[model samples]
Target: MKNRVDFIDWLKAVGMFLIVLGHYFGEPFDQFTQPIYPKQLGVAFFVFVMGWGLASETRPQWQVVYNRLFPMYFWGVVIAIFISLIFMLTKGHPAITNYLPFIGGINVLGNFFPSNPTTWYIGTYLHIILLWALVMRKVNVTLPLILLVLFCEIAIRSIFIEFERLFTGYMLVSNWITVFMLGMYMHQQKDNHNNLKALLIMVLWALLLFTWASLLNPLNITQTFPFRLPVEHSTLISSLVVSVAISTVYLSNTLLAVKFFSGIPANPVVRFFSRNTIFIFIGHMPLYDVAEPIALIFVESGWGKRAIIVFIMYVGLAVVSELLHKAVNIDKLKKHLWLRLN
Candidate 1:
């Protein structure tokens, strides 16, 4: 179990890195440039990891909600304010409108959106955690219930155009429950399945995704959302690929942990990646958003210059995020604040 958990950490490390790449490159696999992994799938994988963590911890609902919600609110608001201020300082203007989403202060109804593009996930995550908390307390969390919730979310979006615009037109918390539930289900059923079976399932999902990708309008889902599908993919396809790939890793890790593939020691690299994923995911975007204009001037059609800039931005933000993560320690601060407020 321990080694299996380690494997999941490794998977998350890889997934998080892919997320950074996906956002930085912007539709990395969309063009026929190369046969690359779907970069946008990274966020979906993160949510999968979230579901797994929820299953593994099995803490009280309030505790789970508190732990997840506060960091998002705290850091999300901070990052929004900070970025808005940077824009204001650099461009010489008031940035209140840019920062409004951070504090739930949108002008129009159904427009309570995050100003930072990446913070949308945090908002979606907040919704998912709250919904899961409420549902877990009310009834047994069956597969049917999971499907029902997903269906309801889709139905609500279909019925209300305004809400869809507010919470990203395509990939809302509602649309994502399926993948999140898949993660929870994977964790709950980990012991019952075998690696070979999981691999087979992954292959089947891949084939299905490929077929669907050929038939669907890929951008239909992401047009108004945080991320659009690469030119020829759909949400269903991406979700299936993300869920199956993560599940495959879980099964493979479990197998390897039991000496299926021996002689691997502690993976410090993977540990670093997992440990700093949150920071990497949150920090990379703003760094790139700021550096992109500069990169364009120095980056002619050459891969070397562009690649170098990417590496520098990623590493620089990672170091800063690590320092901030340690220095701020939001969990402890939240506890302190809660104690005083009560």
Candidate 2:
């Protein structure tokens, strides 16, 4: 279990890095790594890791929710206010909406708060965590349940499209619950020597994803072929199939990663990123949004500019996150809060 925890930390480090890189470089990075969606894979790693960790949790459900969410809520409001203040000083008009609790304090309801767009994950995560705690965690992990969840996800997405409502970030619980459940199922499995089977499954999913990508964009003219999957082919079935395929491939690869790194110790840098992923995830985008214009002025080439921006955003966030962690001592805070509540 100790080694496995280390392995998951490494996985998170890699996932967080990919997400940060993808956000900074966007389609260009996606084009560079064709056939594999790095950002989506990163998200898959996170969702799977969450499910994996939750499988063995012995804490009360409310405790789990509080532990996972309180820090996010605290930091979200702080960042939102900070960004709003920056906007006020720079643009001469305060983003008054960001001062509100749900709109900016939590910053999780879709794109309602522009201060930090990446936090839609928080809302979706809240929904899925609640669902897991209230319902899914108690039920047996079975084929029928998985299929039902997948079908529900597809139906939900289709209904959203039909109603002309943008699904955005907040309402993605249905989209991601299947992957999360799969992670939990994998954690429940006792077999430790399933590397060959895992590899085979990964290959099959990769093939399916490749075939789907080829079919969707035969000419391969679009740079975001596999990663973005052209807007025209956004059918409900296609979207769900592609999403599941990508997630399966990543999940399978995660098993392979665990097998490969069985006895190895986690790298310090990787461990740092893994431990502070929430800070990096929440902090980097806003940092990038503020710093890019200032940093890009010194660079002429496209790749050079992106590299500079990512370097600054990542390193700067790491420093600030470390300082904040030291000052706030979130673990101690959570324990204190829990004691008071109890």
Candidate 3:
């Protein structure tokens, strides 16, 4: 359990860090060819690790999942409101007071929201965890669970078992859930000296991902639209790569990354985001909106220049978010306000 916590914690740091990096590197340069998607690993890893964590922590008692997940998501909603208000004010729009589905989109980051596309993962995550207990209650072990998931995915791919109308929400479990099961399987198989086996698995997964990533969309063989059939090969590749990354961290014995970063306390790369990691994720868009357009204002700016500016903007946003988070600890504030209201 302690190792699990350590491995998961580090995985979270690495996974989320990649997400930030992915965003900074989201778009490819026009002059030079790049991967179909650069920022995907961050998001895919986030989900895959969530699966790994969920599987190990709640193999039996899934009730705890709700207890852990809801507060964060509820706070995610509150943060969205904060962002929406700021956006409205900045854009000179009227105060957003009336209730609407937009809020649903915001709360979970977008299966319903329109602000940004990637946020849908948050909502999907919240919804899936709620149903996970029931799902796991009926399903069996992690390997079998993974197999069932693959069958479900293949059917979805071949158009055998269609649910086009049942639940359009991104939260409805699909391929994402399968990777989650994969995470659990990885976790369950983890043993003190099983590093070789883990490395072998990781290598195999990586090769599969590399092959898929190199081919998908570039060939345009399938319609890889969002929320549609024929899942993007990029997405599959990203998911697999993320799973390998998570598995690698646990399978490796050396704390090389931690040690290397820990040594460079003053290094800009290491220290720049040391504090503002989590908060920045919630509030980055407003900064990005302003920063990206401004970068465009320079008529001669290239993608390389734009990329550099975005990186700087992400850092600045991180700094600002950390400060905002410092100004208010939502959980504590909520408790205090509730006490007074009560």
For candidate 1, report its TM-score: 0.68
lDDT of each candidate versus the true structure? 0.54, 0.64, 0.46
Off by over 4 Å in 3: 1-10, 17-24, 27-38, 58-67, 90-113, 137-140, 157-171, 188-210, 213-218, 221-278, 293-300, 330-342
lDDT of 2 by residue, 293-313 (tens): 867688865877888888776
TM-score of 3: 0.61
Q: After superposition, how far is residue 103 of candidate 2 from its true place, in Å?
A: 7.0
Give per-model TM-scores.
0.68, 0.78, 0.61
| lDDT of each residue in 1-342, candidate 1, tens digit only | 343555456556666766666554545343311112344456656776677667666566777777777776776667667777787878775445444434432322244444455555665666667667876334445778766765565554443332225344333565556667766766643332345654665566556455544544333444433323334443554544433332333333233332211222327766766776666666566666566666667775456555655665566666776788888877788888767755
Quote the lDDT for 289 in model 2: 61
Give per-residue CA lDDT, model 3, range 201-318, as digits (tens): 5565556555545644364332222322333434544434433332333222122222222222233433345445445555454356667666665634666655655565556766
Q: Which wins on lDDT, candidate 2 or candidate 3?
A: 2
Query: Lowest summed lDDT over 10 consecutive residues: which window, candidate 1?
Result: 257-266
RMSD of each: 6.9, 4.6, 7.9
The candidate with the higher lDDT, 1 or 3, is: 1
